[model samples]
Structures are given as C-alpha cells and as structure tokens.
Target: MFIVFLKFSENKSLASQFMDGHNQWIKQGFDEEVFLLAGSLQPNLGGSIIAHNTTLVELQNRVNEDPFVKESVVTAEVFEISPKKADARLNFLVGA
Candidate 1:
C-alpha cells in the first residue's frame, strides 16, 4: 500500500482553480480500485490518500497527471508500505 501526501505549494490558489480536474483525477484512481481512502489534511493544508493495487513508480506516474501536480498547486510525496499484518476483516491486505 501507499500513503501519499499532497503538500500545498506557494501557488496554493491553483488548487481551487483546478479543483474540478483534480477531483476527476482522484475519481479515476478509485474507479480503477487503486485508491482505498482519501481526505483533506488538518487545517486545510492539503490532503492525503491511501492507495494500493499499484507500485510506487506507477503511482508516481499516475500522481503526475493530477491537476494539482500539473499546475503546481501541490507536490506529491509517496511512501510505500509492505503490509505484514492486518485485522481479520482486512487480512487480504497482507498476502503470503
């Protein structure tokens, strides 16, 4: 899985300017079952997303297409995690 942070840039205004397109990009990820969860960060700074079904390199390429990244509204920082354990209901997250 991956924990992705969208850190706001100095050109924060671009976020609202391109909000629609950014949302579309996010929808695409969910539609493809790559993103499992997402939400805004504290104090409205930016946002975060939990994703799977892809590799870091592939995720980077996908994030690059986000309007937020394209218009300099935010910079994407991705951290990959290899799950070793999970609750019974989510056991599928960590496979043998």
Candidate 2:
C-alpha cells in the first residue's frame, strides 16, 4: 500500500479548470479499487490519499496525470505503508 501526501504550495490556489478532471480521476481510482481514502488538510491546506497495493511508480504516474499536478497546483510525496488495521466504520479495509 502507499500513502500519497499532497502539499499544495501556498502560492497556488485550487483551479476551477482542473476540478472536473480531478473529480474524474478520483472516481476512476475508486472504480479501480486503488484509492482507499482521500481528503484535504484542515483549512484546505494540502491533501492526503491512501492507495492500496500500488507502487510508487504507478502512484506517481497517476498523479502526473492529475490536472492539479499538470498545472503545478501541488507537489506530492509518496510513502509505502503497512497498515496493521483499518477502521471498519470508515470502509478503508481492502478486503473487508
């Protein structure tokens, strides 16, 4: 599994032009069973995502395709994770 941490440079703001594409990517990720959880930090400062069973390369490629990344709205750091347990209430478990 991998955790993708997105830190949008303070200089940039979310772009309306990229919103739709970003939403689409989120949908696609969910459909592909890769994206586990995603949300932004408080006050809309950066974001974080959990992707299941994905390689850093694959995650980077996926992020590269994001309109936010393409437009330089945010930079990302990817980390490998070994989740000992996932909250059932959140539906974050890979296999339920």
Root-mean-square deviation per candidate: 1.2, 3.0
- Assess each prediction's global lDDT (C-alpha) against the native: 0.91, 0.77
lDDT of 2 by residue, 1-96 (tens): 888877787536665767798789888888898898899877877778888756678888997887777787778788886666767774554442
Single out the weakest 10-residue window by summed lDDT for candidate 2.
Answer: 87-96
Among these predictions, the greatest lDDT belongs to 1
- The TM-score values for the models, in the order shown, are 0.94, 0.78
lDDT of 2 at 29: 84
* Alpha-carbon lDDT of model 2: 0.77
Candidate 1, superposed: residue stretches over 4 Å from native: none
lDDT of 1 by residue, 9-77 (tens): 999976778999999999999999999999999898899999999988999999999999999999889
